[model samples]
Target: MTIMPNNPPIFSTRKIDLFVPEREELASVLQNGLRYHFVEATVEWVDCPDLTQEPFNLATSGLCGDAVISEISGMSYLFPFMESEFQYSIKRIIKEIYNNFNNGLIIGASICLRLQQQYLVQLGELIMNASFSRITEDDIEIINKSHLAFLDETTGRCALESITNSDPHCYPHGNFFISEGKPGQVLKVRAKKRIGLQFLTALQYSLEKKYSSGIYPKLIGLGGTFVMKSGRARHHIMPYNWDNNLTNARSIHNWLHYCDLDAPLVAVGTLLSSNLVYKDACKFSDLEVCGLTETHFHTFSSNGAAGGHFYTDLESMDPVEYLGYFYPARIFNHVDPRPSCNELIDFTDVMRLATI
Candidate 1:
C-alpha cells in the first residue's frame, strides 16, 4: 500500500517576546519618541533606565496619554520618540536574549520605526556578541542638551520636556554602568567597551559553524523597539535607510549562499514586524535570507521567487512580529516623502523586493 506524506508549514510560531525591566523606563523612552515622531515601537527586547521610565504628559499640550501603550487602529503600541530609542531598545532585547539563548537562538529582532533600522541593526551587532561599552561624556552631554531644548518649550508643552527628563534614574547614571548579576561581584556594564561589527561577524561565523554541524535550531524570532526624531540632524525617518541600502538584503543573500557553501540551511526573513509583508519565493543567496528588512517582507512573502533564501511566500508566516518605529508617509510626505531620485537609487533592490 502507498502512503501519503505531509509537509510542515515554513513558519508557524507567532509568539513575540515583549519585555520592560520596569514600566516607568519603558514609558519614558516610548513616549519621548512619539512626541517627536508618529510611529511607536512594537517591542522592547531590552530595558534600560533611559528607555524605561515614563515621560511627563505635560509635553503633549494636554494631548498625551498617561501610559506609553497608546491605542490606535484597535491595537496598543509604544510610539517612536527619537532615533536613539531604536538602538537602545534593540540592543537591550538582543543582549538579554543572547545571554540566555546563545547560538541556539535563531530569531531576528526589529524596530517598527522605519527610520531607525540602521541604528537598530548597528545595536543588534553589539548584542549578538557579549560586549558592552561605557557611555561617553560627550554622549551624555548631548543627551542633556537635548533634554534642555525640550524644557525650553512653552508651558502647555512642558509635559514633553518632563517626559524626556523624567527618567533621572536611567539616563546618564543607568547607561554608564551595566548589571551586577554575576557571582562574587556586583559587575557594571561599561558603556565604553561595546560589541562591534567584528563581534557580529564572529557571531555569524560561529552560528554558521554550528548550523553546519546540525547542532543549531532551524527557526528564530525577531523584533525590537526605539524612539524617533524628525527635526534636523537626526530625522525621524532615518532608520528606514537600512531597508533601502540593501544591508539586510545582502545579509540574507549571503546567509543563503552560506547554506550552499555547506552550512545547515535555516530559513531566513523576519519572524516579526507586521506591515512589511514578504512574498514567498524560492531561495536565492544566503545573504538574501539571512539579511532582511521591513521591505524584504515582500520577497519574503512571495512563494517560490528567486534571489534570496528558500522560495515561498512566507506571507504572514508568523513567528513573532513587531516594528518599534514607522511613519505614515502618505500623510507626512513633507517630512518623509518618497526619497528623491538619488535616495531612491540607493534602495532600488530593497524597494523592488518589499514594495516599501
Candidate 2:
C-alpha cells in the first residue's frame, strides 16, 4: 500500500544457474540475470514512479510481431500476434529458447501483447472510475484502432526508437544488471496469448448499465509479466510496442504521467528485469524471478503490479476457480491437457451476469 521510490542503477541482474537434464551434456544453462525484491511478502499491489514520471515512458510497448529482437522463439512472437494466436504459445518460445545457447548474448526484455489490449486497460480504468460516461462514441472508435498491428508497411522499430529515446539514463541494455527488484525493477507480464475481450465482461458488468457496444475495444492481447533482474533483471523489461509505422498511436499515445490519478499504464527503464531458465523455474511463464519454485511464490503472488490493474482484476475473480488454473504446479506441466487463458472465462456468461 505504500508508494515505492525509484533509485539509480535502474535495472538489476541476478546470477543464476539452471540445470535442466533433458539432454546428456546439456545439463546446465546459467545466468538468469534479474532478481526482484518485493516490498512485502505478499506483493498485492505495485506502482512504478520512474516509469510514470517524465522521460521514463520509453518502455511502454510490446513490439507486437518482432520475434528476433531478443532472439525470441518463433512461437513466442508468432502465436501472440498471429490473429488466431494460440494461448500457450510462449511454450513454443521457451522450448526453442532452450536450444539457443552457445556463448550467445540474449538482450532479454519484456514485450507485452498488442495495443488493443493496452487500450482496454486504459478504458477499463476509465469505466472502473465511472469516467466512460464522459466520452462519446467517437472516442470509443478512436480507442478501437489503437492495437498497433505491424501489417506490411508499419515498422515496429519506430516504437522501439521512441522508448530508447525517452529513457537514456540507466537503460538496461548493456549487461550492467541491477541487483534487487523494487517498483521499477518489477513489472507485470502475461504469458498467455490474449485477446483481452474477457476483461470487458467484468468492466461492463460492473458498470455500463446504460452504455452500448462502443465501450468495447477491438479484441487483442492482454498478458504481461514481472521481470526481476539480477542477471535476470532487465532482460524482460525492454520497451514493447504494438505500434508500427502505419498503425502508430502517435495521435493518442498512452503515457503514464505520475501526477495523474489514474494508475501507471506504461513503463520502460522502471520495469523489473527478468530472465528464464530450463531448471526449477516455473516452465513457460514470463514472470519467473528465481529458478527455484519455492522462492518464486515467496516473491510474486501474481504478474502485473497492483490489484487495480486489468490482469490483476481478472485473476482476482473467483479465487478458487482462477487460482486452480494458474497455480505453478499445473503451469509447469503443459502436457496435462490444459487450455489457454482464452478459455478460462466465458465472456458472454460473465457480461450477461453483470448486475447493472
Candidate 3:
C-alpha cells in the first residue's frame, strides 16, 4: 500500500491593495498643472505567511502599514515606503511599486530616482548652482524684461550675464525662465521633471497590460527611495539618499531585463544610500538581493551579506521567520558572506515544498 502526494502550501496568502491620491484627488492633480500623481495598488491571494512577514510601514506605519515589506534580490519584498511623504508620498509610492509589479519572480528591485542619470546629473547641478548663486543682476534684468524668451536675442544681456559669470559649461541649453528676489519678492526656478526612458518604457507598457492575466499577486519584491540636497539648516532636504552611475546602474539592469520578472530588486536607500546603489547595481546586473537597514550595516562598517539583508525595523520583522529565511531557489544563488546552516536546511526545504 503506497500513496504519497499532497503538498504545496507551506503558507501562501498575500494581498496588498493600496491606491492613494485623495486630498481632493491631490488638490485636483496640483490644480491641473499635473507634474505627476497617480497611485494604485491591488493584491489578493491569502493563505497567510503573516502577510509577507509583517510588512507595511510606510514610514511609521501610516498609510496603513503591514504589507509593505522588503528584502530585494535574495527575494523578499512587499512594497511601499519605509518613510517620508507629503505630496511626494514616498516618491509616489516608489513609482507605483516600480510601475506595477509584473506577475512572478522579481528579485532585487529599486531603480527610479526619476530613473537616475547620475541622479539627474546631480539634479541638474543643483539647479544650476542654485540659479547661479541665488540669482540677481536685478535678477537677470527681471528675467530679460519679462519678454520671456529667457534669453539670447543678440546675447540677451550677454546670455543673462554669462549665467552669473561663466562655467555651467558656458550656458545655453534653451528653456530658462529663471528668477530670484528683491522685486516684490520673486522666486521661480523650475527644473524637476525628468522621468523619461520614454516614460519608463511607457510605464512598463501599461504595467504589461495591467498584469495581463495573473491579475496581480506575484511581484515577489521591490524597493527604493532617495531625495537629497542636504546643506543643512533645519534639515535642508534629505530622504533615504544614495547615488551611483554607470548609466544609473545600467538602467537598473535594463529595467530588470525589461520586466521579464522572475523577482528581487531592493534599494531602500539611506544608510549610505542603500550601500551605494547596491554596490553600483552589482556592477551591472545579477543582483538577487540588497534590501538594507541595520542602519545600513552600522553606517557602512559592513557585515550584512548573503546578497545583503538587514530590515532591522520594517516595523518589527518576523513574517514567518522572514519568509522562512528567504524562501528558496537556493537563496537565489546565494553569494555567501553569511547565511548557512545549509541555508537553513534549504530554507526548510523551500518552505516544505511550499506546503504542497
Find the number of clashing residue pairs for candidate 2: 62
Error of 1 at 175 (Å): 21
lDDT of 2 by residue, 95-148 (tens): 232222111111122222333435621111100000001123222110110111
Ten consecutive residues with minimal summed lDDT in candidate 2? 123-132
Put down candidate 3 lDDT per residue, 1-356, tens digits, no spaces: 01112121221111222222222332222222212311211122212122111221111111111223322222111011111111112111222332232111111212111223453311110111111221322221111100010112232211111112222221111111111111121111111222221111122233222321242311211111111111100001112232232122232222211101001211121111122233233333543323222111100101111111112211121211101111101001111111122122112132222223
TM-scores for all candidates: the values are 0.19, 0.19, 0.16
Candidate 1 local lDDT, 236-262, one digit each (tens): 111212222223444323221110101
lDDT to native, each model? 0.18, 0.18, 0.18
Error of 3 at 100 (Å): 21
Worst 10 residues of 1 by lDDT: 328-337
TM-score of 3: 0.16
